[model samples]
Target: MCFYDEMKGYHWDSVESEIMNRSRDDVEKALTSSSMNLDGLMSLVSPAAEPYLEEMAQRAHQVTQQRFGRVISLFAPLYLSNECTNSCVYCGFNMTNRIDRLTLTAEEALVEARAIRRLGFQHILLVSGEAPHLVTLPYLTSVVDLLRPLFPSISIEIYPMDTSSYEELIKHGVDGLIVYQESYNEDVYKQCHPRGRKSDFHWRLETPDRGGNAGFRRIGLGALLGLANWRVEAFFLALHAQYLLRHFWKSFITISFPRLRPAAGAFEPPCPVSDVQFVQLLAALRLLFPDAGLILSTRESPYLRDHLIPLGITSMSAGSRTEPGGYAHETHAEAQFAVADERPPEIVAEVIRSKGYEAVWKDWDAAFLH
Candidate 1:
């Protein structure tokens, strides 16, 4: 069975209650546990774990060093389009928003790629809103084909597709796929995505499975914080990650932490996560999944991102633009979201060096697999 089927066994409220009921003793047991299971994760993310943040951070750091060493892989996001058909309430690219939309041609996308490459990014994430008609499979593959030689590693953060479609993208030199569930809570997910293909929660939930089946070397998953309770969201995300790790053993698994940010709709996060709680959740996830890659993005402020790097962040997006042709052309297209960390790639890399870790511009290449 897929994760959607496995997820049905546990109810949201029951999981939330279990986390809330965790006592300090439970937290202590989880901290010292050798095998970090979902129960250990629950106790670590629970409120009782608040008093032990320092301890957890220490353990998380040790685990991170053990698994990933003192290095952070840096990449840039090349926004191919801001056009979307989805009316996601939290997204700036919502179809209903009165914003300028643009989907780049292959040449325009290549221009953006050159700009990102000049910034010393050998790894690129191609981002676009879910505008299937405008950003079709052939269109995406063509752009990937044009960019195959420029970047050593290419990844996509776009719409979900069937397994066959994903396999075609893989053949076109795309090695990674990142899809966020936005909110794992079905009711919340439906409300956030009122109209669009994204409204089908189960399809989106099973996206990584398709990506994995299609042979993507890397599959990224995340739940947008602030849409639901952070602790409960963390629990469900960990559960999903565990499931993928078991079923898709060959594909490297990564998790992203994308907190809600201001965008076109001026939407506010209903269940905002505090900096402390965010730290707790990050530390908990690191302890639970030491080998998994935890990604931090430019959506968070530079100060926060800097302090968070040592806590378990393995990969980061530096010098990112969320609008189509943002790097190369002068366009009026609206960004999918405002970038919080505006530091240039070199500056971000220097900051990473200041923390005594190496900043890796590219960690994987297509040559390595062959």
Candidate 2:
């Protein structure tokens, strides 16, 4: 039986409704309360939380500064392939799309890794579409083996695999995994990912559990903002994060907020998230979980990225190229999306330094993994 079929009791619609019904007073109490829980998180994201954004932001800023200092960890995404079997409607790499498909060989991956290192990035996120036949466990293992010796830290933003597969990758030196739920609304998730392995919501939902079990160092969770009510979706993401933290206390956890950017063969978000609301959500999350790593991507404009530096964002991606072989072998292949902040890595590093924050390149050591 499928994972979802086995866990029929978990319904996303009911949770969404509960979040929608939260009152403003509830939001206030949650923001000011000495201890913030799931209920407090719901209030902070509900309509009732709008008036208290400033106060929440202040508390969040202080908390974030205390924990992470003024430095923002910087990283970049390296797209290895655009080949996918999944049919995610909101992604440019969906299988049905007629776009150039490319997968980096071991040498090609090393070439891209060198370019990333030259850009002063020690942290790298390897992204690919769900093409299990082409990008299987062994293939990923080889890629990790090749790149692990080059970059100290490597994370993957690829399809979900079994715990054993994850364990194998961990043994080969993979440190982190970022698997976004896209949206927790099951019906919406179904409508978006209509075909392939990604269609299984529960398998994806329980992926972090598997990752934690596999003894991976860190697991990242996120929602593609603009797909549904940002507040409701964010609440669920936070809940999932809390669950992972409680269950996997030894493993690190990070959260990302990726606003849906314009992409080929994808629908625009149903409810767009504005700049102010995005900042508010980030601040709210920082206040709720002071130690959690909050990451920003190149999807937002440079102005927004600059403004967000002081508002609780702890990590960022700079000079990102979303298409496969984009850094080393620029091709006309389809990118996951067009990156908004097109500044070169050096320029982005300069911006980060000007903001009085050191741009971190190397934070992890491969020797420690062994």
Quick one: best TM-score, which candidate?
1
Model 1: lDDT of residue 103: 93
After superposition of all CA atoms, the RMSD between model 2 and the true structure is 2.2
Candidate 2 weakest ten by summed lDDT: 1-10
**Candidate 1 clash pair list:** none
TM-score computed on alpha carbons, candidate 1: 0.99
The digit string of per-residue lDDT tens for model 1 on 171-282 reads 9889999999999899999999999999999999999999989999999999899999999999899999999999999989999999888998899999999899989999
lDDT of every model, 2 decimals? 0.93, 0.85
Backbone clashes for every candidate come to 0, 1
Against the true structure, whose lDDT is highest?
1
lDDT of 2 by residue, 101-142 (tens): 988886888899889888889889999999888888888888
Deviation from truth (RMSD, Å), model 1:
0.8
